[model samples]
Structure formats: C-alpha cells, structure tokens
Target: MSQQENPSSLRLQILTCHLAASSRNMASEKEAALAAVPSDSRTIFDKIINKEIPAKVVFEDDKVLALRDIAPQAPTHILLIPKVRDGLTGISKAEKKHCEILGRLLYTAKLVAKQEGLDDGFRLVINDGPNGCQSVYHLHIHLIGGRQMNWPPG
Candidate 1:
C-alpha cells in the first residue's frame, strides 16, 4: 500500500511538513528583522545601557556594564559592554580610539568572572560579524564559566 494510504503515516507526514514550514517561516522572520536594523543603528544593548530595558546587571562602572546573559550558555554567563558605543559596532569595527574601552571591557570581564566564583577557569568570547554569530551589533564580551569547557568552542 502507498504510504498515504496508511492513516498514521499520513498524519506523521502532515506533521513533519507543518514543522518544516514553521521552521522556514521563523528563519525568514529572523532574517527580515536583522535586515531591518542598520549595522550602525542603536541596538537592544543600547536600550539596556540607557535603562530603557531591564537587565540583571552584575557590574557597572563609568566606562562599562556587565550583565547576566539572558540565554546563558553556562551556569555563569555574563556580558560585558562599554557604556558608550563610540562607533564600536563590533570588534571588527574597532579603531585606535577604541583601545581604552576594549581593555576596560576585558578587565571588567575578569572581575565579573571572579565575582561569579569561577575559580576553576572561564572563557571570554567576542563574536564579530554575521559569520561570527554576532546577533547584536554593539561590541560586548561574553564571560562563560561554572562548568567544564570543551576545546574549539562553538
């Protein structure tokens, strides 16, 4: 008998097709949203910095702010970002003027990692452009720890 002749098989096929379509639609929506925002435009991180959006801030100084990552990759995942953009959309866009803020971001990451009690070790990540999996345009450092990290991180 043909696969469609079986009611259970036909139901499973329909469900699979629906899931595939949903996935495609979701992907398309994400692409559209990304395209809608210019690379130099203010991002969600800007909102967080301006206090327009609430975040679980862990550390804050005149130059930088550290907050817990909403989508934590580890038990202790935090994001360190400069309080001012200064045309730093990402590390790839960094200029000589950005050196000071860049160093401050990393140093704050270390301080935050220690505050989180990551005595064993931790990882600091700076995803760049679209190919680098940077969903946000604002420059930020990711501090991930509280678990054993594997090599060649994703």
Candidate 2:
C-alpha cells in the first residue's frame, strides 16, 4: 500500500514553489524595465557558441571565441566571449577565480584588433548591468574599430 502524504510537507512545497516563481517574475519585470535580459536565463549567445546561429568567427580557442557582431556599430565590430560561461552571466558576477578568463578575453580583443588591421586605434567596451545598456545576459567584449569614434558616446 502507498503511504499517505504529509500535509505539512505538501504545504511547504507549495509555498516554496510559489515563492520561487514570484521572485523570478519580479526579476523579469525589473530587467524588462531596464531593457536588459534576465541574468539567470540562457541567452542568444548560447546559440552562437553552439554553432546553432551563424556568426562571422574571427578567432576561436579552447577558452574564448570571437565573432563579428550582427549589428555592426563600426566597420570592425568583433565580440569576444568565453566558450564556457562557468556561471559568469556578466562582469558584475565575476569572482576571483574568473580573473584569468577575463584577462584572456581582453587580450584576445587586442589580438583580433591587430589582425583586423586597426593600426590607428580601436575601442574596447564591456557593458555591465542595465544601467550600462546591456541587452544580452552573457558577458562579452566589444572590439570596435575602422572609424573615428566621438567622445561622450551617443
């Protein structure tokens, strides 16, 4: 015979699930208001990394991958990101252990810029949370070049 379920345990489970869902809803609303993606969810970058989406890959290694941005802000706009996230949703979530990969990403950006023939100069940008206008949840470096950039970026 099957044992009866405990009423107290059942109620606790229901309450826990409700609380978790409510928290997620609240976070989603906040992200939406700021025009940012949810941090805890898998973003479009995953597709790019998995080769499910087409991207002009400029560089790739075991640790990082660099690809041309679909919507290019400059003549040469490359995005560099870690192949494996390892819980690094954004730079804001970086821990001490992530330092090596973070440095590798920046160094990769410089290497790509040289390969792209940006002899004059190049710009590297990393948008953090919502205030920084980060629409994607994944952490990435934007290597932009091939034009004269204006100060006080628009």
Candidate 3:
C-alpha cells in the first residue's frame, strides 16, 4: 500500500513498525521497482523500497523485502521483491545464476506466510508479463491469503 495508507494496513503496519522500532539496522525499503518496461531505469517498487514512496513492509532483510500490495488482489496480498535486482526482470529471464536467489525468494515467501499467522494455507503467485497482465515489470512474488484460492485463476 501507499505510504499514506500504511497506517491502515494493520498487520503490515504493525509488523514494520515493530521491526523498525526494534532495530536501527533495519533499512527502509526503497520507492518503486528499480526497473521498468522497455528495460528502462526505475519503477514504482524502487520508491517503495527506498521509502521514497510508502508501503506497509511486512518483512525485510539485506536481500529481500516483503510488503503489502497497494492494489491487493486478495484479502491478504503481499508482494515479495528482491532488495537488489541483479538483472532479474521476471521468471522468464531467470538464468542458471538466478537459481539461488529464486529459491531464496520462494523459501522466504513460505517463511513469511507462516509468520503472517497463516496456519491454514496461502497461495504464491508470480505474474510473468503482459500475457500475465503484469503492469509492473519487475519480478515479485505475490503471497495471497485469508481465503480459499482455486486453480486456473482468472
């Protein structure tokens, strides 16, 4: 969510505030994605990561950042993104070198879902490209929860 709406994001706000308040080592997520379509520089995610823009950060570390999605598609929609791109635009662009970080991202998502009090279940999604209806070009793992999700999602 936007920084303006962070206070209202409830769980996310609480988590981030608690983390930030607990540790000064916690680096603020930037504003927007670092990369955009046409392979240009800077996307909305970079702003969010930098805190240049605002987002309800749920979890963060030196390598990754998890935050609430501004345009949530589910009751619990959190986007997990790499703190640094390192040339990973999406799954399609994933190279052999990307395997380690990719695995870390998925594992982290699992860790985050559990940490979010989702003992029942959760869904992980990655919108690939235009065909995937992805408006944002940067790669992000969408962790959706709080309901039953179906196969062949529309």
Candidate 4:
C-alpha cells in the first residue's frame, strides 16, 4: 500500500527513524570534539606553559607544571598539567602511551597537596568533557583543599 494511504505505517516509520537518530546522537553526546582534532594543537595551557600569561606557578619540572588556579574553588587550588600536550586533549583521549604523563599528573597533585599543607585531605578532579564542565581541552588535574569537600559534587 502507498505510504500516504497507510497513515499508521507512515507514523511508525517516522518514529522509528527519529528514535534511531536520537539514540545515535545520545551515544555520541559524551564524545569530545577535541578527540577528532590534532592533540598538538595549541590550547590556553600552552600560554600558561610558555609564561606568556602570568600564573601563580607552584611547581615545575621538565615534564609537568603546577600552578595555582586563578579561579580557586578552595583556599589551596592548583592545576597540574604536562609541559607537553603529547596528544592528550583530555583523559578520555588518553592512550597507552599517555600512562606516564597521567601518572605524573596525579603524583604531582599529591605532592603539591602536601606542600600546600592539605594534610587533612584534598580533592583531585579530572574533568573530561561538557558533562564534566571541562572548559579547557588540555589534560590537567585539579587539586583543591584547605576545606571539607562535599560528596555528590554537582
């Protein structure tokens, strides 16, 4: 039968197509656009690394750099990042080769927490995408402390 004559079948087909597309879009919603881009592409982190923009640098090495976040969520808030992007746009884009840098970033967060006298405790956050509220594409660990952290962080 012709589609127009079969109104119910037409409605079903439209609903099915819409549902399929909706599912696919939802599946990809968690994906970051940066994942498709070259990881070496410069981000604002490069400016912080290059010292073109002044940041309260707290720690630095040949591999990693830690600086106090300008918009501090806690009394002691620092951002630990790799000196080299190395195709690490975010943790979601991390590959096996990124293990070393990822480890360094986390370890640096711990060491800096001690230095900041957050012996009580601290929070390390790696925001991945829009849902994580990751404004910058570069991979960095946020170390926040000097106060009690609430559970179920929004």
Candidate 5:
C-alpha cells in the first residue's frame, strides 16, 4: 500500500510480551516507564517501539524491533529501531561507546532484509539530519530492496 492511499496505515501485530501490570494499552506496559525521551520524543519510531502506533513487525529481539515502513520507497522498506533509545539521534550522534549498538542495528537490518526474501540484493540507509532528509530524530536503519539499486543514492 502507498502512503497517499492510506495515511494512517500501520501493519503492526502484537509481537511483544507484557511482564508487568499496566492499563489496557500496551503503550502503558512495563518498558514504557523507562523511556527517557518519552514526552520530548514523539517520532514515528517512538510509536513503533511503544506500541502506541502500529507497525508490521518483521523481526524483534530483546533490544531491537524491525518493521515495515509505512511510506515505502521500495518493494520492501523496513525500519530497524533500538528498543532502548540510548540517546542516539542518528549516525552522527554515534559516539565511541555506541559501537555495539551501531553494529547490532546494522546486523539486524541485514537479517531482516534476508528474511523479507531479498536474497538478490538490498541496501541499508541511515539518513542523518536535515541534509540527509531525516524527518524522524530517532536512530533507525532503513532496509530497502526488491530491485536493482544505483550508486550515489541521493
């Protein structure tokens, strides 16, 4: 589906397990309390991670969540996000200590893309700030595939 066709289209299914008591919504679940930028951060990622907003969960782990992008640029466009924000805004905000997370996120992207049946080819993108056309502030890995990509992707 296209963004223009259905603006609020999120293909998420319940992929998380609750370990604490909260309200009816999973958005109020256990991890919700630990969200550092909970209020200050309202990006699509926040919604995807918090279960406040829905998304097609492609792959998930204790520290990560991979889902299909609502606004797909390719036949397969998935966003890989950290379950814990850890103050990462983008690739630029990555510090020396972020090596583990940075690697994990990328590794997860490849795994997700392959799981999507993109054995032919795929691309991993990390859009930075304004110049990088990054609308969302949270760090995310864009896994695009199902076609022959080109160089100098702009």
Candidate 6:
C-alpha cells in the first residue's frame, strides 16, 4: 500500500514534517536573536575591556588586553582583544586603519601564550561570524594550548 494509504506511515510522515518545521523555526529564532543587536554595538567584551565586567586579566597593554577564557576549551585558553574596537566587530570588518591594531592583537597573543608557558605549542583563532561560532561581536583572538590539538577543528 502507498504511504498515504497507510495510517501509521502517514502519521510518521506528518510528525517528521512537523519536527523539521520546528527545527527550522528554532534556527530562524536563533539567527534573529544574534542579529537583534547592531554589529558595531558594544558586546560583553566591551564590558570586560571597560572593567565594567570582571575578568581574570593575564596581560594588558595600552592597546590590547589578554584574559583567561571563562569557558576554556583548553587548559590555557586566553582571549586577546583591542581596547578600542574602532568599528572592528570582526576581522571581516577590518579596514586599512585597523591594520596596526590587528597586528598588535596577534603579537600580544604570542606574548600571552609564552607567558602561559605553552612552550610546546599553542593555537590562535579568530572566529568571524555566526558560522564561525563567534558568540561575541567584538573582534578578538583566542590563544588555546596546554594539550594536544586535533586536526580539522569544528
């Protein structure tokens, strides 16, 4: 018998369709929430930089701040961010004027990694957008180390 002619099969198909639609709606809602705020608006990183929010700062210079990650993926996960965002919400938003600061962020990451005694090795990551799993809007670099790293990171 055709699936439509079988009540059980028809019910299963309907349920599957319902679940798919629900999943799509949930994804849409999540995307909407992520986009609710303007990209250039202040993010949690801004609060941390401003000292409005407390963070375990490991290193700080005139232009950059390196702090321990709240939810560390590795034993030595630190976030390096520029004090003045200057419209750099992500690396993709970088312009010519942002070059200096960008270089500074990377160099500071290196310094922090060395300070953390990741003498063996470390990884630097800059997640750009929603697909990159970037929860924060402000541009920053992640210095992860203290364990063996695997290839093809998600």
Ranking by TM-score: 1, 6, 2, 4, 3, 5
Tens-place lDDT digits, model 5, residues 1-154: 7642332321111112232324343343223322322123667687778899877898999888998877676888888988877778777887888888888998898788778899998999886643344556688898999988877563
Cα lDDT of model 2 by residue, 25-93, tens digit? 344433432444345677677888899988889999999999998777789989999988888888999
TM-scores vs. true structure, each candidate? 0.77, 0.75, 0.73, 0.74, 0.71, 0.76
Q: Could you tell me how far off, in angstroms, the CA of residue 141 lies in candidate 1 after the best superposition?
A: 0.5
Please report how far candidate 1 places residue 121 from its true position, in Å.
0.6
- State in Å the error of residue 22, model 3: 43
Report how far off residue 113 is in candidate 2 (Å).
Answer: 0.4
Backbone clashes in model 1, listed as residue pairs: none
Residue-level lDDT tens digits of model 1 in 1-154 = 8764654564454344334443343454244333432268888889999999999999999999999987777899899999999899889999999999998998888888888899899999997654454567788898999999987553
lDDT of prediction 1: 0.77
**Clashing residue pair totals per candidate (backbone < 3 A):** 0, 0, 21, 0, 1, 0
Q: Which regions of candidate 3 are displaced past 4 Å?
A: 1-36
Error of 3 at 59 (Å): 0.1
Task: Compute the lDDT of residue 89 as modeled in candidate 2.
Answer: 83
lDDT of 3: 0.70
Q: How far does residue 108 in candidate 4 sit from its true spot (Å)?
A: 0.9
Candidate 6 residue-wise lDDT, 38-142, digit = tens: 367788889998999999999999999999987677899899999999999888899999999999988888788888999999999997654454557788898
Residue range with the least summed lDDT across 10 consecutive positions in model 6 = 29-38
Runs with alpha carbons beyond 4 Å of true place in candidate 1: 1-38
Off by over 4 Å in 2: 1-35
